[model samples]
Target: DTAVSQTPKYLVTQMGNDKSIKCEQNLGHDTMYWYKQDSKKFLKIMFSYNNKELIINETVPNRFSPKSPDKAHLNLHINSLELGDSAVYFCASSLSGTQYFGPGTRLLVL
Candidate 1:
């Protein structure tokens, strides 16, 4: 089984629409992060949760939030999507010094 997984592998929505990407980890890591990769392939961490509790929140827009239902799951929800929001979103979990990433969710805002 994959260590990390995400749902809605591909999402296409309008600029003002709302969407979500679900992520789950089976590695039993305590820390999970939501990252965004732009067209330039610049990856940036948007949110971080430890044990299902948010611990690190970067300068992400207020419309973006991380919802964790359990220690093994951390989902990303975005409201009022924009064209600039079109990118590949990744979910990752880390333990010790190694990080495991999901297959990634590609989101496109028309």
Candidate 2:
């Protein structure tokens, strides 16, 4: 019984490498989102998909792309990872304003 799940709770990678984080939700929510929390613990919305359509895209780098195969899953792919990309990535879901987030995927770039 998983509400929201993401793979590799911790990821340590080298700069310029490409990696992908997978996410899935058991809740029947129509909207899903990806958020990034920096070292300061500032949570910011990166992307949001509603019914499989791109809804929100923040000032994230083009190297970061989000894919939503279905309402239950949204995966994030990063290319040419940088030290600044070393942060925690979170996947969330919601039908309205209230969203539920995953534990988070911590990426450490060296």
Candidate 3:
């Protein structure tokens, strides 16, 4: 079974559109996270959820939202997507600080 999985591995849309990416993990981890990798290969954490409670990174914009229905799932929603939002979004799950990442969802904003 996959430890972590993300849906719609690729997303292509125009600027200002809204989109969402879904993530699920079967690893029974208590902590999950959303990360974005930019074109320059810089990876940054956007949001984190531990047992369904949110802990968002201060640098993340309000346009980005992370929702967790339970410990095994975390979904990301983007509103009024901008060109700068085009990047690879990764879903990760951790047990005691050791993280396992999903394949990632590539978003392209035109």
Each model's RMSD to truth, in Å? 0.7, 0.7, 0.8
lDDT of 1 by residue, 1-110 (tens): 88899998999999999898999999989999999999999999899999989999999999998999998999998999999999999999999968899999999999
What's the CA error at residue 106 for candidate 3, in Å?
0.3
Model 1 weakest 10-residue run by lDDT: 92-101
Residue-wise lDDT of candidate 2 within 1-110, one digit each (tens)? Answer: 88989998999999999999999999999999999999999999999999889999999899999999988989999999999999999999997688999999999999
Native-referenced Cα lDDT, model 3: 0.94
- Which ranges of candidate 3 are over 4 A from the true structure? none
Clashes of each: 0, 0, 0
What lDDT does the true structure give each of the candidates?
0.94, 0.94, 0.94
Model 3 lDDT tens row, 1-110: 98899998999999999999999999999999999999999999889999999876648889998899999999999999999999999999999889999999999999
Clashing pairs in 2: none
Each candidate's TM vs. the true structure?
Answer: 0.97, 0.97, 0.97
